[model samples]
Target: MKIACSIHACSLSCSNLQHGGQRLLSFPLSKQRLDQSNLRTMPKRKLSQSKILGCSRNPQSAVGAPRAKNLKTGQAEEKGIGKFRFWTDARRFKGSEEKCIVQKALYEAGGVRIGGYPKASPIPGPLGFQRPEDWDFLWAPARLALKALPARPGQLVSACPGMMSLTRKRQLSMTLKGSLGEDLAFSIIPRTFSLPDELEAFKKYLEKQRSAKQVKNGSAAEEEAAGRCKELAVGNSAAASDRNDLWILKTAQHLGKGLKLVTADEAVREAAKRRLKSKKAKPYVQAQQYVANPLLIQDRKFGIRVWVLVTGLNPYRVYLHCNGLVLFSTHQYSSETWRTEEGEVALGHVTNYAQNMDGMVWDLKMLEDHLGKDAFDTLWCRIARNTAMVFSSALPQITLAHEALSVQPESTFELLGLDYLVDDQLHPWLLEVNGTPSLAVEHEDLKVEAIISKQKNEMVSDMVKTLNLASRFEPRYTSLRLAATKTKSLAAISIEGSEVEEGRSEHTAVNVMSDAADGQTTSSDPQEDEEADIAGVVQNSSMDVSTDGEVSGAAVASKNSTRQHEIRDAAEHNFTEESALHVVSGGSSKTVQTVISPADRIDHLRRQLREEMAPTTDKVVWFRVRQELQQLGGFQPLMPMFPMKSKSDQNVSGHNMPWKDRDNELVSMLGKTARLNKRAAIAAEKKP
Candidate 1:
């Protein structure tokens, strides 16, 4: 049986009673909202691997050349923003599989979101990592997507496992190693969360005067030379991203939520003490890259909670979820703002949703009312770029980690929460990435968390349907489920581990896709019911197969815009020669030099799903999103692409950015030919 519980928002009984230690801060328990329904949980799990043997390539850089006079993003006299254009599918097949394509493999970074008795064998730790059930979860920021993503349905596959390790998030390979290395495969994954020592070292790197003289050797210099960031700071004019200094000062760090702000001089000693109190023997409060002059909500500080789904590494496949929550601070923001007698800025200064739920708004309704659609979107794109940067930095480490552990590509996935804070100038600063973000929706603001929880449920549900984890995914043959099993019905199981209606029609399954839905399915025809178990014999080409499993008329012509996972191209997708890889799976994922004949992969997908879909073309119809994307709000369904490319492929033709990112760029690129460009120019000239 499935249960859906809603919690009413309760006022907090929290106060900054103490500074550090377990008494750092305390909250009296509000009445629990769950009764027969106490706490609700979003069902999810994961799988993933990495590559390091020259296999990890740098993240694909944004294609647009830096505009000379683009909108300034930094707090200081507005440094130039790296306004990149969007990238089109390098190659999309002209006549593709939009017909037999069941759905995109839409998973959150990587994991299984369906809750219950795990259908697969249990791993020692969460997602195969060495984490204990009662493991001390260090505090971290929860991130959410600031942009809309392409969404579809199959079964369930999530990107960020509830517990995340940037190492797993940035893996660069999908292939498993075959030979046993001389000793063992050496693995090293980079840390997404920083320790006190790393923070100190980073600070030194930022303070140029000492950075150049800190007795740093060639290796240190080389490490610094690798990709990183521009400058930024809390002081509106100070360089935030470029600097080595931390703008945040915590009197102590042991206090997870009880963290106190400190000055530069007191930071080092307090951090040391905080590290000592760490159960894992590490510092929990490291210097956060300061977001100066942050964009505020109703004069109160806030942060965005975005979710990113990463399916594989090497060819890093990323899916940014469209819907997310905007959290606000309790107190109004002001540079001159501080507490009584003490120069401390409490929750108001920080945008943590958990910290400042009192009187804070949920919908970005406040921000939108203030900045309007154009400004908010531009800010979101900047956040997306910063997010990509974070992944790019960790790519190499993740690749190596995967190689060392011999992780299989399709076997693992991760769902990560990406937190971001945009400055007043609309410049976004990276906060911290959380490994396991709380999926429970019973925080102080119950009403808001409940809404967010519901959205998450829907997002995960669609994702499950697309991945076929509910019915088809077999843990043993993880990667080639489609290739391994030609005839099997996942309809027997749902993500929540509930029994699915044994003989339901494909159309019947859609209505009951929710966790609360009883897995009951119905069919109009009895003959079709008998054939459900026997996957219609898959021929070399789906175009040749009819609804009754016989040869049909010529295949319907498909449009070229169908999009699939960045790393995975399965189910309903048309892969051009560039996208399809020839695989010879015999206990190994060996990608042959040549491409897999399109007929084989696409046909295989058709055969497996034949039992699950309707004969009508509606089974593979596209969804439209121009306002709020239950998936990208403004995206056309035909364009399976996010960050859609420019229709005119001119050198000067700017890449079509996700709607928000494209607003300003649209004017810059198409302004000349656009009739509205003159009005835009006049408006620009009018600005002082």
Candidate 2:
């Protein structure tokens, strides 16, 4: 059958991109208008607008609905988002009635929530601006991550981890942040005022990523800058300042967060007012220079959301998580086109999940694979370090400026939501820092929310482990203390052997005494008069306690002390060195003893799990390709955990492709035998 090459082409999707751009590119908007056959002939008279989101709507039924409901549904422009809540640091208004204000159901149509709450809000505060304080504010995740790490300088004595002496956590955090930002500028970031030649040089990255197929997911960040997308130049001197302020406004109305960007045209203003239902519409900011060319992915602009956890304040530490969401614009990238429209084409620039739900790519692997693993990994590391440096540079000033925001560095931690955009050179530019970055993903689609939630939970779980919150709940310090006590008992057993052999016992006594000097102790050996003398000498000084002919009792005692200390240390080390130990579940309750390193034990258990989880050899014929994945123990892809019905029904609830359509492959995964069997029986029943 011959397929029609019109705008309303049937049965075509993003996968059809391989077919060639001619059929899919020009008529992309045709799919939205296909359902509005009624308004085609009477385009202007009918005044019909398709929903910004891809949801189908009944025009006739919706005519009876309230206008406000329709706007809330976002059928006229972008899909309407649910009630939004905003938090303000009320302490800024300490003298006034408002200490901290939690405004519920915030409408993000306007560019600034600057003075909306508490009747009359206070002037610029730490939270209002994406100030350095905001970036360094949340310390909990960082604190937890620090605690979780196996290696450390020493015990964290003060509130802040690795605090040498308690004095100024705030000042330290601020100073570190400032220094980090500067370091990034020197090492990774291109100078903001780099000449035109340098600017053009960086643009080469745009082509690189395009060739690599690294980006191309739909993009838009809902509230990166008050619900609008902002172009943040490395230096404030760039002419992008005006355009930055303007486009951020366009995101609200054009992208569907709040309202559309209003132009000076009186007719356009009147038309927008009809949708807003306000007497006089909010005036648009004065237009200046348009943000220059933006790097695009497959003819589409892109953006990313970065997260940073400041683990400590005293010495200022930062944790940049390895994974982040890459968003793409729905409309193809055309700086030429968006520039003419006065920043109204949010679909071409913004990349918020709500704005582009189908475009969200959670896994970092896709990008890494596209950009060449090494290149991508290197760029990724640079981005993470840059993030740390940005806030670190600002930390000192931030802490000094906000004295009221003080907290016990250890007791509190802050997580910053950093938004970013990459230029042609692949150099990432920091857009804005959100102190209260929303851990929440509020969306009409449950699947979108679930995906975002899972993504967030993964990061949170990592942060928890990094902070070592598990150790906090576990009785680790107590165990270590007890082990210290047991250390002395070990000395007693070794000291008895000292009596049987003077040379050996004397050597051990000297070692023991040396250890006792360091605060660890061993029981006094009553039988060896020489050991007592040796112990005293070893404890007193580092000088040798033995003479050429006769061994000093002080030196002998020190040797015993050292031997005892070694035994206790070994016992303690054995308890903590779990890298070689593996505990297997046995059929019986009997305790089994096996000597193995933690690594070997882990490998053994993993091997067992792989075997247990592995599909039977008889049934493995169907999944020969995924056999390696089953055998390997790291991250593995599986079918959607949702019901099979939901997996097939993307419109109802499920992940985007290829995350959505892995059921057949999932049937062969480990621990999926029951599901495979159930599906097999169903298939057999339908075979007749």
Candidate 3:
């Protein structure tokens, strides 16, 4: 059922477009020639002369030179260049717009030589085209119609399986509440109940509220009759009696389509009637507590549109766009106004850009300017924490879905649009998760359109960099492939032992240097000398060593080095006693029982993956990708808060960071994985 087609580069309509008077190069695109596996083995061919260098042409340059051109500047760039292809099933997107945007993005960020979907001739039966697996990258709708284009291993996908569970209103509400417990879920998101299914529970909630109200009113009346109530307190009692009874009813199937506010009593009555009259028991609507006291600007309510990229599951890797859009409602907001029909006409409560033609929006920087620096920082911290928690809660289901699909976790990624409504307390409440948030903007205002376009472009570019879709930067993919194909699988093997050895090597080198400085000869072990020589070379590359044989560098690095030497010396000295390390002791000599912190465990894992398993590890790949992202003029990472800690725990050891807000679940999962991998690696290393 899988068809593989070869798309020739010469067939592209835009192939001859003028690029700074120098024509952009196009490869054969023949599957055998362009496929990554065959790229190195393919026969070399001469490249034609460019218009820019028409005076002289060198056929030899075509064989070894990088010829990929930048999509924006049309200049030949040597950095991160590779031959990659992209395809789009634009049925669900804005057809031509989706194709154009993706094609350009793939050429620029993907490092694809020629970016375009293969044109179908007057042919039948899949148009004699390639299967989804053939393409380097795919852009499909959020529906995830796998049957139409079955998900295959090795192919990069736009959507993740089982994403609808988080995207749908009822499912998301039920999942979050079930996984995180009602208390935490209700605090993060509004208390939500799926209709029909949770009708009895809703009724009980209403009944409890009514009973409490009746008791309060009766007590007040009794106090008044007994002459215990003061005349001035009557107004205060009446004011206190008013409750937040407003609830929003949203269609489970559609978002921003049929949203309306209803009172608790009215909702209960409707639920009761639906339970009695309905033949089917399917959940059609969800009742959520409306956020009446929303954080507003210019007296208008707004909701933040967060763009989150989920690149992994289990220990999920999330990168949040720090500069997400802040969508503002066109009309001024007031809880009292929403109660009237005229207020509903003004659409003062809704902040969805699609619903309002003249919607006002601001990127995070603009919002930061509106709110002072200190206030913005505080607000952003909470938002980041809440967003991480939401994903952590959904980790179980996402993992199951990923397993069911039988695809590599690294091969799949999902871009989610997480909306949040901030209360007056600046606490952001989760609104809804979008599996395939739209990138296209249809705003009439040119300024708004320009802002959205810039943000979208930057986000998409960063996503490309993060995923490493380009062939040359395929370390993550290559490591995974090697692990998959090996008979003795090296999957998830920890390199902690290597790291521990490295530390010891550094300690030995420092000792040797100190002894030499004191005019003393140290041990003449070849390994020790080799390590010391390597360390000296690295240090000398950055800065000069002192004339008196003293090491000198930046104050911070010098201080950290001193701390490392002290810790290493102490660990060695203290753990030498057999009784102190009796549990891990084996064979003749007592073993050193140094605590492998979470950071050390992760570092070991990354190193082991690179040295033992493949040339580069996922961590190394992510680190490089992060560097690319930081250089961009857009959002920054929000998860994996302390990436540098994995390299050296000393980097963030003394900061008073909010430890309570850390993703403990992810950290725990990583630690467990590292331990298991370490055991496996040690066993393998011991094999004769």
Best by TM-score: 3
Per-residue accuracy of model 1 over 466-565 as CA lDDT, tens digit each: 3333223221111122332212223212332322222222323432352125332322123222221111111112111122221222332221112113
Which 10 residues in a row give candidate 3 its minimum summed lDDT? 536-545
Predicted candidate 2 versus true structure: per-residue lDDT over 1-688, tens digit per residue: 1122222222211111111111110011123323444323433312222211212222221111111223334453212111111123333322232211111112221111221123242322122122111111122223222332221111121123332111122232223323443343434332221112222332343335333433343332323342222243222232333333232222112223533432112212332332343444443311111234566657776767766664443333345666566666667764333333343444565555557756645445656676678877676755765564455345434344223433332333455566666776666765445444545554455665565555565665555444433222111222222233333434554455554335434434654564467553333212222211211111111112122233456765786465344333433343223323334435456766554432222223222222222212322222222322332222222222222234447552112212212233443343466578799999999997
lDDT of each: 0.34, 0.35, 0.51
Ranking by lDDT: 3, 2, 1
Using Cα atoms with residue i matched to residue i, what is each candidate's TM-score against the true structure? Answer: 0.42, 0.33, 0.58
By TM-score, rank the candidates, best first.
3, 1, 2
In model 2, the Cα lDDT at residue 194 comes to 17
Worst 10 residues of 1 by lDDT: 130-139
Model 3 per-residue lDDT at 239: 23
Best by lDDT: 3
lDDT of model number 1: 0.34
Q: What TM-score should be assigned to candidate 1?
A: 0.42
Model 2 CA lDDT for position 649: 77
Alpha carbon lDDT of residue 480, candidate 3? 28
Runs of candidate 2 exceeding 4 Å displacement? 1-291, 339-346, 401-406, 441-454, 471-688
